[model samples]
Structures are given as C-alpha cells and as structure tokens.
Target: MPAVSIDINMFWQIINFFILVFIFNKYFKAPLMKLMDTRKEKIAAEFSEAQKNNEDAALKNKEAQKILKDAKDEATKIVQLAEKKADERKEIIISEATVQRDKMLKSAELEIQKMKHAAKKELEVEMNQLAVTLAEKIIKENLNSDLEAALADKFIDEVGGVK
Candidate 1:
C-alpha cells in the first residue's frame, strides 16, 4: 500500500509540472517573443541610423575641408592682388616725387641765374655812371697837378662804390 501511494504521488508531481509548462506556453510565450522581437527591431533601426549618421559626418567633413582649401586659395589671390596694387601705387608716388624734385631744382637754378644777371647789370650801370662823372670832371677842371690828383682820388672812390 505504501509503495503504491509513493508511485501515485510521483505521478501527480509530474502531471502538475506539465500543466504549469502548458500554462506558461499559453499565457506568456507569445507576448515574451513579441517583446523580444520589438526590442531587436528597435536595436537594428538605431544601428542603421548610426551608420547613416556616420556616413553623413564623413561627407560633411570632406565638404568642410574643400571649403577651407578654397577659402585659403581665395585669400592668397586677394593678398597677391593687394600687393600688386600697392607696388604699382608705390611706383606712381615715387615717380611723382621725382618729377616734383626735378621741377624744384630747375626753378632754383633759373632763380639763381636771374639774380646773377641782375647783379651784373647793376655793376655795369655803376661803371657807366663813374665814367661819365670822370669825363665831366676832366672837361670842367684845368690840367693842374692838384686838380689831376683830386680827379684820380674821385675815380678811385667811384670805382670802390661800384664794387
């Protein structure tokens, strides 16, 4: 009797375990599998978005590099143009300055020549006046020794005044 009861108890435990397994399969398996599938799809979509973002980043980097190079090249061209213009302007300024200097020098030389000619003319006029005065004295006075000495002194004084 005891052995039969033990065998029956073992049989009941086995049947109970099978019933629990069936309940779990009927109630939980499909929902669990659906949740796992949803999670797996979400993960795959995120991975795909990450790969797309990475590709976009690479393309943007290349575009940025190209833009930077173009900017540098444009800056170089601008600097070169500015330098060329500056050099041309410098040459123009120097040329104008040189012309101005030459004109001033020529004007100075002409002024000096005018001054020298005026001085020479003044000296000639003074000499002519001295000659006229001496001739008049000779004609008015007698040819005595005292008169001659006085005339000579007057001529010397007039000539010194001319100098």
Candidate 2:
C-alpha cells in the first residue's frame, strides 16, 4: 500500500527452496516410505505366523490328552482281564484239591476194609484149630478125616452159621 520494493534476494530464496524440495522428494521421500511399508508388512506376517503356531500347539495338546485317556482305558481293561483269569485259576485249583481229597479218603476206606477182612479170616482159622484140639482132648483120641469134617460142620452150624 506504501512504496512497493522488489528485492532480488527474495527471488533467489524462492528458487533455493524449490531446489531443496525437489532433491528431498527424488532422493529421500520415496525410499523412506517404501522402507516403512516393507517393515509394516514384515511385522504383519510375523504376527500371522505366531498365531498359527499357537493354534498348532493347542491342537497337539488336545491330541496328547486324548492319547493319555485311551491308554488309561486300555490299562483298566487289562487289569480287569487279569483279575478274571486269576479267579478262574483259583476255582480250578480248589476243584482239583477237592477231587484229590475225596479220592484219598475212598482209598483209605478200601484199605481199612481189606485189613478188617484179613483179621477176621485169621481169627476164624484160630477158632477152628482150637475147637479141633478140644474135641481130640475130650475124646482121648485123634479123629479120622471123615469124623473131623462132620464135627467141624456141626460146630459151625451151632455157632449161628458163622463163616
């Protein structure tokens, strides 16, 4: 509004400012922005990889738990089977022992019966010999074969048919 003064230095200053802007845009701005974008992509990719690894770990942990549970079930079945086999074996052993005991008792009873029969036979023979001796003494003479046979038969009949 007063006297307008044009300075030549102002023109030079404007030209210098434009040259510095052009140099920075061509040499620094594009490369710095590209580097920032690459860094951001690398960080995003790392985050995705970390998330995938976490999911895989969780799945593996679940699989491990399932395997452990199956092993426990199998062990329980094995133990139950073993107990059943043991019970069967115990029953078989007891039955065998009982059969053996019964057989031994029967054998002992048979042996006792045989011994009793032998003892009774010996006593009868002794009694018959004593009777023969007494008859010979009472008659004051030895008996002939026919008379001795008759006498023994009569004595046996008198003694209630003892054999």
Candidate 3:
C-alpha cells in the first residue's frame, strides 16, 4: 500500500483514552475512596466521645455545688441551735440566782427581828430589877416617917409598871 485510506481517522486515540480511564478506576480510585471513608468514621467517633466527656464533667460540677450548699445550710442551723441553747441556759441561771438571793434576804430579815425583840425584853427585865433594889434601899434608910411610907408605895407602883 503506497498510501493509507482516512476512514479510521482518530479511532485508535479514543480507544487508548478509554483503557487508561478504566485502569485508573480499578486500581487507584476504589482504594482512595475506601481510605477516605475509614478516616471520616474515625474522626466522627472521636468527636462523639469528646461530647460525652463534656456532659459528664458538667454533671459532676452540678453535684459538687449542691453538696456545698447543703453543708453550709447545715452549719448555719447548728450555730443557731447552739445560740438558742445558750440563751435558755443563761435565763435558767439568772432565775435560780434570783430565787436564792430572795431566800437569803428573807432569812436575814427574820433573824434581825428576833434579835431586836430579845434585846427589848432583856432591857425591860434589867430596868425592873434595878428599880426594886433602889426602892428597898430608900425604905430601909427612912422607915420612921409618914413621908417615907408614901414614898415606898409610889416606888413600888413605878417598878410594877415597867413590863
């Protein structure tokens, strides 16, 4: 053949292009897609785990705050109760002291009254005895006169009226 015909113009070039595309899909494209899917799944699993950990930490913080509030409330109640008890004890002590003081004052007053009465009785008895002795001395010294008889009667009446 001195010169070829042009009926198969560009046919060999198109066939070579299709074979290259098929070989690249079978050997490189499929494996690349599988690797990309696996990496995406791993990243998604890590993100989910991080989210769960954050939720757990938030719940723990809330519980800790609640416990702290409860402890503070209990402490306040204990302090108030102690103050009330102290007030009650103080009142009881004051009342008991007042009662004891009153009792002691009454006892002292009664004792003083008894002492005063006994002193008055002793003074009256001594005065009467001295008056009788003086009268006897006067009578013995002046027995021979009428004036002496009248004096003796007056002395006896004075001595008898003392008590």
Name model 1 segments beyond 4 Å from true: 1-13, 138-163
Steric collisions counted per model? 0, 0, 0
Query: Each prediction's Cα lDDT score?
Result: 0.88, 0.86, 0.86
Better by lDDT, candidate 2 or 1: 1
Tell me the deviation in Å of residue 2 in model 1: 17
Candidate 2 per-residue lDDT over residues 42-132, each given as its tens digit? 9999999999999999999999999999999999999999999999999999999999999999999999999999999999888877876
Model 3 lDDT tens row, 1-163: 5385545656777777888899889898988899999999999999999999999989999999999999999999999999999999999999999999999999999999999999989987887778777877778577877787777778677766756
Q: Model 2 lDDT vs. the true structure?
A: 0.86
Query: What would the TM-score be for candidate 2 when compared with the true structure?
Result: 0.66
In Å, residue 43's CA in model 1 sits off its true spot by 1.2
Taking all chains together, each candidate's TM-score versus the true structure is 0.72, 0.66, 0.61
Which residue pairs of candidate 2 clash? Answer: none
lDDT for model 1: 0.88
Considering summed lDDT, which 10 consecutive residues are worst modelled in model 1? 135-144
Q: After superposition, how far is residue 143 of candidate 2 from its true place, in Å?
A: 12
User: What TM-score, to 2 decimals, does candidate 1 have?
Assistant: 0.72
